[model samples]
Target: MLIDSGSPGAPATIGISLTINGEVRELQVAPWTTLLDLLREDLDLTGTKKGCDHGQCGACTVLVNGTRINSCLALAVMKDGAEIVTVEGLAKHAGQDGAMHPLQAAFVERDAFQCGYCTPGQLCSAAGMIAEGHATSREEIREAMSGNICRCGAYTNIVDAIEDVMHAGAAR
Candidate 1:
């Protein structure tokens, strides 16, 4: 809970500790601060885009405790002590100095990102979806990834890229 600072309007900040991109970070955040804002504004991790600002667009997707959630819809303080992963962390966890994550490599190989605005969210969402191990086929993948939208109309290529990684068993 946020306490008023005894003033007319400023709400006191609450301390939150979140493990982001494998780094443990302790910070203060206002109760109303959204995870997207905390990541982009406070932490300067702008890889997670803020599109629609509502839950409809998957542009603000991020993995919290290994599960994908819409960052824009999530309160930063609510995820205190949680482990979060963004697009920037995927490659680092992929095991090498310059290697890209399988999904990242596949997306590049298949030209999955056109305009690229939705790529970050798509990548994070795909990573989380793959980890869930629910998408078994092309149709299933499409259904599972339906929550993410690409305005550049890269649906086919995105699906193909994800399918490639999924079939190659490179993604967990």
Candidate 2:
């Protein structure tokens, strides 16, 4: 159900469908609109931040098709029909439903964040890394998460949270 927002070229707009946070969103966006801009500005999914917008800071990291990527470097049009999960989607199911994801709970238990600005990206990156399942040690986790920068210097706690989740998954 992609709605034709407008035509391409001159004032060209393209219609794209993205499954964001388990919801299908059909939107009309410009070709040059980066995924970061599209999420924050158009879709109003601001959980993916815009730090260092050049794909360096990884603040705009999100899960696209089950892989972690920097949204700031991706064009919205390029991700048509992709399944995207932002930080907002991480804990959608909560309370009695046992909604909070393990990573989220671990962050709270480990005191994984300081300024909290980088928490979203950090969470998303950890989720993706855990899914990838290549990192098992603290050093590997840090290396995998190097793209996301936390200026408040909460690296140790972040690693602890991620490691807890990984080991828990192994036990399961």
Candidate 3:
């Protein structure tokens, strides 16, 4: 049975398996279904925001197999069998103690967000960057996080928050 893509045109469905937020989900997705839509529309993981929807904005960022990727640019079928982590998953993975991830907490402490629309993408991207272990300095973090646009102009605070987490992670 074909499922509606929630768009005006109901596209044909293709089966895909995704391990999302530590849960294995098997679903039928349209060939044109972007990973962002799959998460927000199909799975209802709305934490991963869809800002530009054209991959220009990093609002749909998520981790796929421990690497940061713009979910808007990826097709759901292309990520079959891949491990996906959205903001919700990152929060859950950080601690079962019900505390926020260090980066998330740092963001708040540093006032890294204004309107908060880009916070999810920024947090996920920073978490992934820390996992990548390639960025160690403030300048490096700035460069690495350039893809995520915070229209609120909180770049300095965002970098500060990310740096705080990176240093803390290093200590642990």
Each prediction's TM-score versus the true structure = 0.93, 0.89, 0.91
lDDT of 1 by residue, 38-115 (tens): 899878999999999999979999999989999999999999999999998977765646788899999999999888
Models, CA RMSD each? 2.7, 3.7, 2.6
Question: How well does model 3 score by local distance difference test?
Answer: 0.86
lDDT tens digits, residue span 11-50, model 3: 5688889999889988888898799988988788999999
**Winner on lDDT (1 vs 3):** 1
Model number with the top TM-score: 1
Clashes of each: 0, 2, 0
Using lDDT as the measure, which candidate wins?
A: 1
Error of 1 at 6 (Å): 13
Residue lDDT tens for model 2, 1-172? 2224454444557888999988998888777788888889877888889899898988889989989999999998999999998988876522214467788889899999887888889888888888898888899999999999999998999998888889888311
- Model 1, residue 121: displacement in angstroms? 0.4
Q: What TM-score does candidate 1 get on C-alpha atoms?
A: 0.93
Q: List the residue pairs that clash in candidate 1.
A: none
Q: Alpha-carbon error at 12 in model 2, in Å?
A: 1.4
On TM-score, the stronger of 1 and 2 is 1
